[model samples]
Target chain A: MGRTSDAKERILSAAQALIELRGYSALGVAEICKAAGVPKGSFYYFFNSKEDLALAVIDEHWAGQRGNWQRILGDDDPPLQRLRRLFEATEADQRAGQQSCGTVSGCLFGNLTLEMSNQTEALRERLQQIFEAQVDMVEEVVAAARERGEVTVADTREAARSVVAQLEGQVLFAKLYNNTRRLDALWTNCLALLGAASPGRAQEAPVAPAR
Target chain B: MGRTSDAKERILSAAQALIELRGYSALGVAEICKAAGVPKGSFYYFFNSKEDLALAVIDEHWAGQRGNWQRILGDDDPPLQRLRRLFEATEADQRAGQQSCGTVSGCLFGNLTLEMSNQTEALRERLQQIFEAQVDMVEEVVAAARERGEVTVADTREAARSVVAQLEGQVLFAKLYNNTRRLDALWTNCLALLGAASPGRAQEAPVAPAR
Candidate 1:
């Protein structure tokens, strides 16, 4: 890649890490620049403003996710299994140090929305577009799930929406509680909502199960 | 109350609104002072730091949630019914024009854990305690569901945990998607999970007239 492209990628990656690490709100432009090993000029050289940088960071962040997310959501398995695999992959990322946990992303996007939703129609539209894209992506999987007979749910669309909500809530809890176990449980419930039980879902005797 | 005390309340309320409406990140002390109609010197006189003010904001926000939430979660009704009511309340809040839906609290508590979980040990412990407290609160009702035969699930504790994950997930989805509809579906599915199926639930659907 060209030097300019490398600098841009460096800035974006730094933003992702810090945003994931310290959050967009907590971390300042100086910190981002320090993390990226780039000068302030390079930062503003590429992005017009802090909000612009944040927007770019969000764009770059999700743009990177689309392909990985699609791969898992669009794998060779049945739609339901593909969905589970996608979550399992997410769980793996959470475990293997891929923070950002879209669940926690509300702090930035929703935070920005609160600050600018009134003043910046452009940002609001951008946020809406990103989220709609997510819902649509999920809707595609739910439609596939219906075709696959994996779930006899009454409404695939609503089910898809709930799955998104469920996944997002789990991320927040995981962050709050600093435990990934909820991720497992939430993913299991996702499958359950789609008519598939989580692995080892049945509760044993409240006492001990005799081996 | 003294004028200083009144200023504190104004600062707290202003901070709460701004944190929920704007964000906790660098919402300048000046902006808050302006919003609260308090003098800058008076603001500094009340709180030690912006974060100190933020903690107070969270406390106040939590207090505001108490009456409404207690009514929904701790009512003189079935645990399942109470649960559904809580979800319905979220729907009402969103439709009523408050953009700051608790669906995604941007959960100040959770957000702190995410940003500071790495740097500060005391904050880490505090965040864990908060989550445990909330989880315990929810588990109380989940335990009732177990005793009353409302929930046919095997393990009430696990069932309760599963429910919490869904609730948190719905919050994130609501905010990320900027809509409360998913929160509504989350309530419906949660009710179903607890075995309180209505006309919407598949199992509760009346048998088709002998076609």
Candidate 2:
């Protein structure tokens, strides 16, 4: 049974990697089957259609992020520290692995929404709901800072949403320009927003009080 | 001669609308040909290839923005006021039209870059040059604020690039959600970045204390 599931896991990972670069429309079943090194007969054994393949890609991507957030947020460090650490980790990860583009750029879910989400309202809602869940992950951290009396926000929920929005946008531009530095700017700005939205997020900056 | 040029204009406009929604790769030449009601031979006459057609669409879009800036930016109002006014105008325009998703969501240049720009350095550079040109336009406004004793920045050029980045990020999220409200949040955050980056810009804020 474990061996049976290994093929499915490999197929999902291969699809995630390909979908990030080529987009959902351009990625064909044949290409995925070839990339996964699975037979065409075996491809149908798991997914119902290309759409099913895409959802699996999104789900697998989501599943990975779940583990990622757990590590970043659960660290022993302070809330602000953990937040910055996550940003740095994201920058490093995006640059090293795959080297195709930003972790968030050309996301299979994003590509699906742009290309065919409207035609598939269920998929659209699912993507939106999933993305919102990611936003909530950030909100949890922001709220923790608030509890610690380390952060203040115009609206914690909105701030978290904005952070994710900026991160998502940064991914698109970074990939568009093929520069990892773009991701860095986004990381900086997100930190700025977190600080500015809070009372004092600039502990590292050494604020000199007005004389 | 005028009639011939208008037909060409109509063809280009139709192609732009379709391409933005579906992306350059998935947008069939035949589909564009059908939507524009231009014969395939006529398309060949106007554009040597689909890439050429895409290039023309980009040229047209840029030309339209130039004209738009002239009308809105050159209004008798001060530049800062004109800037806010233009934002309102853009917001209205998109709501009434295709939701201006310009350079925000699925930008044609951005979309094409992800799909084919990597295949050629010349094409990549062309697209990069175009993005830089867009950034330069926004820089003019930031520069004006600086000169008028109304803006300060650690780096105006960096600030300009970040503004472009923020706008790019926001638009993608906006289109992803199919909600203009999300887009407005991005615009608000962008202006806030401007405010934070330049001491000079803060005084121009609606509620800032007079200098």
Candidate 3:
């Protein structure tokens, strides 16, 4: 049982890494298996198909990141500050990814959605559920900020969607340009969208993750 | 010569359609040829390779859309109104696309960038050039708006890039949701970003193209 679980974890990690780097359709099961150091039979035994593995990848990836998100957005700081910290953390992640891979991979959900939304109904629905959940989290943050008068917006839901879209879009730009500065620009714009005063460039460093 | 040009046009159109609907890496030369009803030999005769054909598709697709952008952004209307008209036209185009294909196919440049930027350097550079050109046009409009005291922004270039990013990002959402209403929300948020007043939802129709 221990050995079997180890192989499953390896396959999930390998799929997440490769999918993040290349995309959904570009990478094959063979490459994923090779990267995971697992046999083909084990792959099928663990997951029914590549699509099933992708779904697991999404869930597993989000599961690992959800804690970071909850900690960042659920901080005791002012809502606006918490939002800034969340983006700062994102910038740090992108920078780390660039240093490791020579390219920023952007959001896995966004990448898969762009590549496979129209091609695969099951994958698209799964991604939509994940994004909707993320957007809800953003909405909650924005709503709290609005209640406290830290943020001003006519519609909190729309504002949240805009914030999420801006983040995804800027990440896409960073990946395309292979530069992290685009993320800083995105942060600045995000500040403006939230009706918060620009704190200048002094806040580019990633805040330490909450304990 | 006429027959040769006809075949070339057909191939370019088909490639654009397939690439926009799917993505760069997911579609192939043979599939494009089959869609265009052009023989494989004719496809090669018209373009050197699939990459060359992709470049041509970008060029041709932009050629078809540039006139609309110029007409909308270059109109005699106020800068804010012109910008609104530009977005409204974009929404109309997205709506039409959704109606025709039952899905929102986001911006071709953005879709390609996300899919192929890391894998294909030539294609990435070509896309960068095209995006830069588009950004230049946006900067011109934004600079003009700033000069006229219509749109107040700290930096014209950043504002223009933000606008482009927002447009690309929202289209991505529209594509992901398979819905056109996201475009409306994007326009509303864009107004907020530009510090323009919400002219409300009455202006959903495509503004008349400049004569």
Worst 10 residues of 1 chain B by lDDT: B202-211
Model 2: clashing residue pairs? A152-A198, A169-B169, B150-B200, B151-B200, B151-B201, B152-B198
**What fraction of the true interface does each of the listed models get right, in terms of native contacts kept?**
0.28, 0.20, 0.34
Q: Score residue A113 of candidate 1 by CA lDDT.
A: 41
Residue B103: error of model 2 in Å? 16
Per residue, candidate 1 scores C-alpha lDDT tens digits across B1-211 of 6787888988887887666555556589999999999999988887887866766665666566666777677878988777777777766665553444433333455445544554445555555666665666666887787787555455555556566656655655555445656565655566544443234452332111111
TM-score of 3: 0.90
**lDDT value, candidate 1, whole model:** 0.61
Q: Please give, for residues A141-182, the per-residue lDDT of candidate 1 as tens digits.
A: 877866765555566666666666566656655655555555
Q: After best superposition, candidate 1 residue B67: deviation in angstroms?
A: 3.6
Candidates, DockQ: 0.34, 0.28, 0.32
Between candidates 1 and 3, the one scoring higher on TM-score is 3
Ranking by DockQ: 1, 3, 2
For residues B31-135, write the lDDT of model 3, one tens digit per residue: 998999989999989889888988888888888788888888888887767777888888889889888888888788888888888778888798788777777
Each candidate's interface RMSD, rounded to one decimal? 7.2, 7.2, 8.4
